[model samples]
Target: MKKLLKYSAFGLGGLVGLMLIVVAIVAATFNPNDYKQQIIDLVQAKKSRTLKLDGDIKLAFWPKIGANLGKVSLSEHKGSAEFAAVDSVKVSLALLPLLKKELIVDTVYVDGVRANIVKYKDGTTNFDDLLSKDEEESQTIKFDIDGVNVTNSAANYSDEGTGAKYSISKLNLKSGHVALAEPIDLETDFTVTANQPAVAANAKLKGNFLVDPATKHFVAKGLDASIKGDLLGGKDVDITASGDIDAKPDTKEFLINSLKLAATGQFSGAKLTIDLSAPELKALKDEVTSKEAKVSLVQEKGSDTFKANLVLADIKGSPKALQSSGITGDISGVQGKRTISGKFSSPFIGNLENLIFDLPKLAGNLDIKDPALPNGGVKGNFNLTLHADAKQELVDSKFDLKVDSTQLNGDVAVASFTKPNIKFNLNADTLDLNKLLGTSSAANPAEKTAANQKPADLSALKNLLLDGKIKIGNLIYQKYRLSGLNVGIKADGTKLALTGLNVKLDDSQIKGNLAISQFAKPLYTFDIDIDRLDVDRYVTANTGATPAATKTSDKPLDLSALKALNADGSLRIGSLKYGKTKASNIRIDLKADGQKLSLNPLAAKVDDSQINASIGISRFSDPIYSFNVNIDKLDADKYITKSDPNSKSPAAKSTGDTPIDLSALKKLNASGEAKIGWLKLANVKTENVSIGLKAADGIATVSPFSANLYQGNMS
Candidate 1:
C-alpha cells in the first residue's frame, strides 16, 4: 500500500507541473489583442452593432484568471451612434476557488464608463437587442467579491413617450466585500439631472448594505445621505438624512430605526429650514407603527420669521387605515413689531384607501402682540373639527375662536380642488377694527388722490368661486361704529356680488348691494340707502387757523382711472348733515359710461329750501363740467363757516381781493346756470337770483347775473 501511495503522489505532482508549464506557455505566446477584430466581427454579426476596441486587450493566468480592457465602445443597434463606452476596466478571479465550485473575485476597477439608453414611443429600448432573453431557469451561483471601485461614470436615459430626459454624471462608487445576503460597505457620489421638471442635484451616500435578489430583502445600516440641488421650481436646497432600514416588499414588511432628516432651502429670498426625526418605525401588510416622531421648521425673511414644531406618538396604521395617539404642535410668527404664537393638539385618524382624514377635536390657544394694536394686542383660544377627502377633493372645517372680548364661529367647506367652489358661514359677536387697526381721522382729499394713484391688481380674483355669509353683532372701523351687520358675498369667475349688506351706524340704518364684473376692466353697479347719516360726526373738526400754503396747488388731477370707470349707482340718504348744513331726503343718481359721467338727478331739501341739480362730466382729464341748478329758497349763511367769537385768536378777516387761487378752475371747463327764488348772503337778502357761468380754457365770465333786491332789479 505504501508503494501504491508514493506512485499516486508522484503522478499527481507531475500533472500539476505540466499544467503550470502549459499555463506559462499560453501566457507567453497567446495575444488577446490579436482576437479583438474577431470579437468585434462576431458581435456585429450577432447583435448588428459596431464594437470598437481602441486599446489593446490583456490577460493573465498565473495567480489568477484576469483581463484588462481599455477604451472600448459599442454602437447603437444597427446604427453608428455610440450606445455605451468604457475607458478602462480590470477584473480577476481566484483560480483555486473553482475547485470547490466557489467563485471569488478580486477588487474590480472600472473608470470612465458611459451609456445612453432610450425608450421609444413604441416601448422599445435602444439596447433591446443587446439584452439576452433566457426562458429556462438557471441554478443559483453563490459568489463573493473582494471589492469594487468605479469612477467617472455616466448614464443618460430618455423616454420619447413622455418626453422626459434624465442623466447621471460624474458618478463614483467604492465598495468593500460584496456578497449576496451579507453586509457590504458602499459609498457613492453622483450628480443627476432631469429635464421633465428641470431638476439638478449632487448627492452622496455611504452605508453598510445587504441585499438578496432571491428573497427580495434589503437592509441598510448606518445609512447617511446628502443632496444639494436646485429644485422645486428653481429653489436651492440642501438635504441630509441618516437612518437604519430593512425592507421585504415580497412579505410587505418594513422597518426604519433612528431616522433623521434635515433640509435647508431658499424660496423667493426667504430662508427655510426643516428637521424631522423618528425613533423607530415598523410596517407590515396589516399593521404599521412608529414610536415617536417629531418635525420642526423655521422660515425667515428680513424682519419676518416663522417657526413651527410638531410631535406624534404611538402612530399605528394599516394599508387601509391609520391612527395616531395624538399630534401636538406649536407655531409662532413674527413680522416687525407684530407677533403671533399658538399651540395646538389633536388626535388623528385616517382611511387611506378612501383618501379621507379627520381631526375630531383640535384645540389651540393663540397669543398676539403688537405695539400699534390697542391694549398691545390680544390672546385667544380656538377649537376646530376638520375633515378632508382627497378622492373627493373636499374639505370641511368648523371652528370656534375667541379673542379678547370677541367671539367668532365659522364653518368653511371647499369642493373640487380644480376650479374650487368654496362656501362659508361666519358669525361674530364683535369685531373691533378700531382696536385692531387703531382709530384715525378721515383722509384728506390729497391723501385720497394719492391712494387712487396706486394700481389695483385683481388678477387673482379672475377664477374665484365663493359663496359666504358673515354676521357681526357689532363692528367698529376707525371712528365708524356699526351694529347688526350682516353681509352676503357671492363670486363666480370674474364676477362678484355683495348682497344683503345691512348695518346700523349710530342712529342710521344702511342697506346696500354692490356687484363687480370683468375684474380686469371692472364694471361696478351698486344701490345704497341710508336712513340718516351725519358726515360731520365722523369728520374731525378743523378748529385751528388755516396755515399759509407753502407750495402752489397747480398739480394736475389724475382722473384717468375715473374716466375708464364703468359704473351705475344710486345713493339715497333720508337725513344727512355736513358741518352746520343739514339736508333731508337727499338722492343722487350716478352713471359712468366710459367717456362720460352724469349725476342726472341730484335732489335735496335743506330746512325750508328745496334744491334740484344735474351735473355732467364729459372730459375727466382737464375736466369739462356742465350743471343746472334750481332752488326754491336758500339761506347761504347756513352753508358758510362761522367764526368762534370766544377764541383768543380768530381767523384773520379777509380784505378786498383776497387772493383766490383760480388755477384749479383753469383746467375745469364748465358751463352752469343757477336760479334761486330767494337767497340770503351775510346780512343781505334777495327775492330772486339768477346766475350763469361760462369758463373754458383758462377763461371765466359771469353772464346774466341778475337778482331782485331792495325793491329793485340789480344786474
Candidate 2:
C-alpha cells in the first residue's frame, strides 16, 4: 500500500507542475487585445450594433483571475451614434471557485461610465431590444461579490411623450459583500437634475440593507441621507434624514424606528427651519399607527419671527381616514414690536373621503404685549369648535372668548377661498374702544391737525363680502357711553350697509340706518332719529362768570376731505336741550357733494315760536356761506343769557364798543335774509321786522333794514 500511495502522489505533483507551466506560457504569449476585432465583429453580427475598443485589454493571473478593459463604447442598434461608453472597468474572480462551477467575485471597479436612455413617444424604451426575454429557460447560478466600486458615472433619461427629462451626474457608489439574503453596506453620492419642475440637487446616502428577492422583503438599518439644493424659487435648501426601515410586501407589514428629519430653507421670502421626530411607526395592511410624533418650525423675515411646536400622540389612521388621541401645540411670534403667544390643545379627526377635518374641543390661552396698549395689551382664554371642508373650501367655527373684563361669544363661517364670503354673529358684555386702542376719550374735539385732514382710505372695503350682527350690553366711545347697542352689518363688493342700528345714551333712544357706496369716493345715505337728547350731558359745562370774548383760530380750515365726501341724510329729534335753550320736534335735512353742502328745511319749535331756516356753504377751501331765516314770534329773554351782577371783567358789563374783531367775517363771502313777525330788544317790542345783509371782497353792506316801531317804519 505504501508503494502505491507514493506513485500516486508523484504523478499528481507532476500533473500540477505541468499545468502551471502551461498557464505561464499562455499568459506571456497570448494578447487579449489582438482578439478585439474578432469580438467586435461577433457583437455586430449577433446584436446588430457597433462596438469600439479604443484602449488596451489587459489580464492578470496568480492571486486572482482578472480582466481590465479601457475606453470601450457601444453604439445604438444599427446606428453609428454611441449609446453607452465606459473609460475603464476591472473585474476579478476567484480561480479555485470557478473549478467547482461556483462564481465568486473579489471586487469590481468601474469608472467614467455614461449612458443616455430614452422613452419614445410610443412608450418604447431605447434599450428595449437588450431587455427582450430569452425564449428558452436558462440555468441559475449562485454568485457572490465581495465588493463593488463605481466612480464618475452619469445617466440621462427623457420621456418624449411627457416632455420630461432627468439627469444624474458625478455618481459614485461603493458597496461591501453583496449576496442573496445577506446584509450589505452601501454609500453613494450623486447630483440629480430635473427639467419638469426645474430642480437641481446634490445628495449623499449611507445605509446597511438586507433584501430577499423571492419573498420581496427588505430591511434598512442606520440609514442616513442628506440633500442640498436650490429647490425653493432658487433659494438654498438643506435637508437631513435618518431612520431604520423594514418592509415585507408578502405580509403587508412595514415599520420605521427612530425616524428623525431636519430641514432649513428659504420659503416665500422667509427663512424657515423645521425639525420632526417619531419614536416608532407601523403599518399593517390598511392600518397605520404611530406612538408619538413631534414637529417644530421657526420662521424669520426682517424683524418678524414666528415659532411653533406641536406634539401628537396615539396617531391611528388609514389613507382615507385619520384620528389622533390629542394634539398639543404652542405658537409665539414677534410682529411690529409686539409679542403674541398662544398655547392650545385639541383632539383631531380627519376624513379624506368627505374632505373634512374637525377639531371638536380646541382650547387655548393667549397673551399679547404692546407698549402702545393702555394696560400692556390683553391676556385671554378661549374655547372653540371648528370644522373644515376642503372640497367646499369652507370653515366654520364657534368660540367663547374672555379677555380682560369682557366676555364674547361668536359663531363665524367663511366659504370660497378665492372670493371669501363671511358670516358672523357676535355677542359681548362690554367693550371700551378708548381703552382697547390705547386712546383717550378726554381729547379735545376742537384740536385739529394736518394729519387729520387727510382723506380717509376706504380702498379695503371695495371687495369685501360680509354679513354680520353684533350685540353688546354697553359700549364706550369718546365721551359717549352707549348701552343696548345692536348693529347689523352687510357688505358686498363696493357697497356696505349698516341696518337696524339701535342704541341708547344720556337718556336718549337712538336708531339709525346707514349705507355707503363707491368707497374710494364714498357716498353715504342715512336716516337717524333720537327720542330725547340732553345735549348738556355730553358737552363740557362752563363755570363761574363768562368771558367777554372768546379766542378763535385765524388759520383757514382744511376741507380737502370734502372733495371725496358725498352724503344725503335726515336727522330728527323729538326733544333737544342745550344750556337754557330747549327745542321740540327738530328736523334737519342735509345734502353734501364734492365741495358743496346744504342743510335745508331746518324746522323747530322753541317755546311756542316756529322757526324755519336754511344754510348753504360752497368753495370749501375759501368758504362762502348763505342763510335764510324766518320766525313767527320771538321772545329774546328766553334764549339770551342773563348778565352776572357780580362780574370781574369791566368789558363784561360795558355798554360801549366791545372792539369785536370782524376779520374772520371779512374773509368769508356771505349773504343772508331775515324776517321776524316780532322782535324784542332791550325789553322793548317791535313788529313786522325785516333785514338784509351782503358781504364780499372784504366789504360789508346792510340795506333794507326796516321795522314797524311804535306804528312807524325806518329804512
Candidate 3:
C-alpha cells in the first residue's frame, strides 16, 4: 500500500509539473496583435459585426487558467458605419467551455472610457447593419466589472423621419463598480443635449451600483453636475446650478441633496454649474416649486442656505394643469384688482428682482411701482417698480408687468390716471371711451397744413398732454356720436365735482360726477366750476367743421335742434349767473328711471333796451349751442344802440331786427329770469321796450319776449 501511494504521488506530481509548464508558456507567449483576432473570433461567435477592445490585459496560469483586462467598451448599433473608443478595461477566463446556447463571461474590470455614437443626417448610424443572428438573439449581457470610468463623452441621436435631434455631452461616470445581469442594470452618465430644448440638462453621476440581476433595477449615489441656460426669448431664465442626486430604481424614485445655483449673466443668457444628488429630475423640479426651497454648498460645511424670491406659482407648465393665477401690487395710496388670466397684459406692469418673467400668456395681478403703468411702446406685462420724490413728485420708475391677459367686470372698463390715487373710472358697455382715447391723437398743425390735411395717429392724444393733476383745460365736445344728449362737469375751487356727464357712443353724451380728492385730506372730495366750455371739440376726434359759403341770419332764434338717443339730456350743474346775482350749487340731474332733467335756477342781469344773457350754452356736442335769456321790460331804442351789445354773443346768440344794445347792459341795472330748456335759451325782458331777439342755431329765442318802446321804429 505504501509503495502504491508513493507511485500515485510521484505520478500526480509529474502531471502537475507538466500542467504548470504549459500554463507558463501560454501566459508568457501572448502576442499583442493576436488580441485583434481573438476579440474578432469572440464577437463573431456572438454574431457581432464590429468588435473593439482597449485598455491593458492580464493573463494568469496560461490559456487554460484565466485572462483579465482592465476595461473595455461594448457598443452596438444598426448601420453601415461604426464607432469605437476605450479606457481602462479587463476580462478574465474566456469561458469557451461554458458556451451552449449561452455566453458566460467571467472576471471583468473597466475604468475611464469615452465613446460617441452618432446618427448622421442620411438615415444611417455609426454602426449600421453590424449585428449577426446570434448577437441579435442574445437578450441580455452579464457584467462583473470591478472598476469603470467614463468622462467627457458625447453622443447625438437623430430621428430619420422628422429630423428631430437628441444629444449628450460632458458625460462622466467614474470610480464605480457595478454588475449588470440584465441590460437596464447598466449604470451610466447623465448629460445635456442640444436636441432636447425643454430638457436643459442632466449631468453628474458616479459610484457603486447594485443592480437587480434579472429585473434590471439599479441604485446610485453621489451623482452631481452643473446646469445653465435661458428658457423664454430673453424673458425668462435659469442660469445657476449645483446639486447631488441619489437614485434607487427598485423604489422607483430619487432624492436631491446639496443643490444650489446663482444668478449671473443675462438671465436670458445665463449659465450654471452644480454639485447635487437627486433621484430623478422630477424631484429637483418639485424642489424649485417649493414656497421656500433651501440649497446648501456642495463642497463646504458652512454654507448659507439660499431662499428663492418673488414666488409666482408652481403649477405644472401646461395650461390645463392650473385653474387660475393672480398677483399683487401696491403704491403710495392706491390699489385695484383685475383678472390676469383672461385679459390683456399690456395695460399694466409688475416687478420682481433677479428674475425676468415675461408672461405673454401668464396671468396674474399687475401693479407697476410707477404710480401709473408707464406709457410707451413696451408690450406685455412685466416686473416693474416706481419711485416718487419727497415732494410727492414722480421720480425713477421701473415698468415691469405683474399680470397678463386680465378680464374685466362689466360695470368698470378702465381707469384714467393723472395723479397717484387719482384714477378716473370710465364705463362703456358697448365701447370703452378710454380705449378710444388711447387710439386717438392729434398731429401738429405744422404737419397738418393745407398740403397735409390727413389725420395723423390719433391714439397718442394722452401722450401729447401733461399727465398729472387737472389744470383747467378746455373741454370741447364735437360731433357727438350719441343723439339728443347734453352733459356737463363742474368743479368749485380746487375740488372737482362732475355732474351730468355721460356718453352714448352711438348717440349723445351722458352725465356723471367730476369730484376730485383734496390734497390735505385725500379722503375728502372737491367740486370745481367752469365758466364756459366749447361743446363741439370734446366729442369727435380727427375732424373739423368749416363753413361753406356762409350766409347771414334773417330769422329770430328758434332754439330746438338737439335730442339724446341713449343718454338723458342734462346740463352739468354749475353756478347760475344773472343780473346783480350769481347762484351757486347749480347742477343738472337726469333721472335714469324717468329720464327727466332739472336745471339749476339762474342769476340774471337785466337792462332797459336789451337783456344781457349771463348763461352759457354748455350742452350738445356738435357745432351747435344754446344760452339766451329774455328781457321782460326793455327800451328797444336803448337796446339796439349801444357801443357793444354784450360782446359775448357772436356765435351763441341770435339778435332780431330790433337789435338790443347788449353791450350797454354791463353798465345798466335791470332784473329778470333767464329761461332755459333742454338745450334752449329763451325770453328776456327788463322794462317793456319790446325788441324780439334770436341767436345762432336758435339756441336762444324770445317771444314777444322783447324790450318796451324805445327804438325809432318797431318791427
The best candidate in terms of lDDT? 1
Highest TM-score: which candidate? 1
Could you give candidate 1's per-residue lDDT for residues 348-425 as a string of tens digits?
998755678999999999988887778988888999999999889999999999888788999999999988999999
- The better candidate by lDDT, 1 or 3, is 1
Candidates ranked by TM-score, best first?
1, 2, 3
| Residue 303 CA displacement from its true place in model 2, Å | 12
RMSD after Cα superposition, model 1:
10.0
Worst 10 residues of 1 by lDDT: 449-458
- List candidate 3 segments past 4 Å from native: 1-16, 30-82, 85-128, 135-143, 151-154, 165-173, 180-220, 228-369, 373-715
> Which 10 successive residues of model 2 have the least lDDT summed?
448-457
Q: Each prediction's Cα lDDT score? A: 0.88, 0.86, 0.37
User: How much does candidate 3 score in TM-score?
Assistant: 0.34
TM-score for all predictions?
Answer: 0.61, 0.56, 0.34
For candidate 2, write residues 537-609 as lDDT tens digits.
8777776455435656665555555666688999999999887678899999999887788889889998778
Off by over 4 Å in 1: 1-284, 291-293, 301-304, 334-339, 369-378, 433-449, 452-455, 477-479, 543-566, 593-596, 618-621, 637-665, 677-690, 703-715
- Evaluated at residue 15, the lDDT of candidate 2 is 97
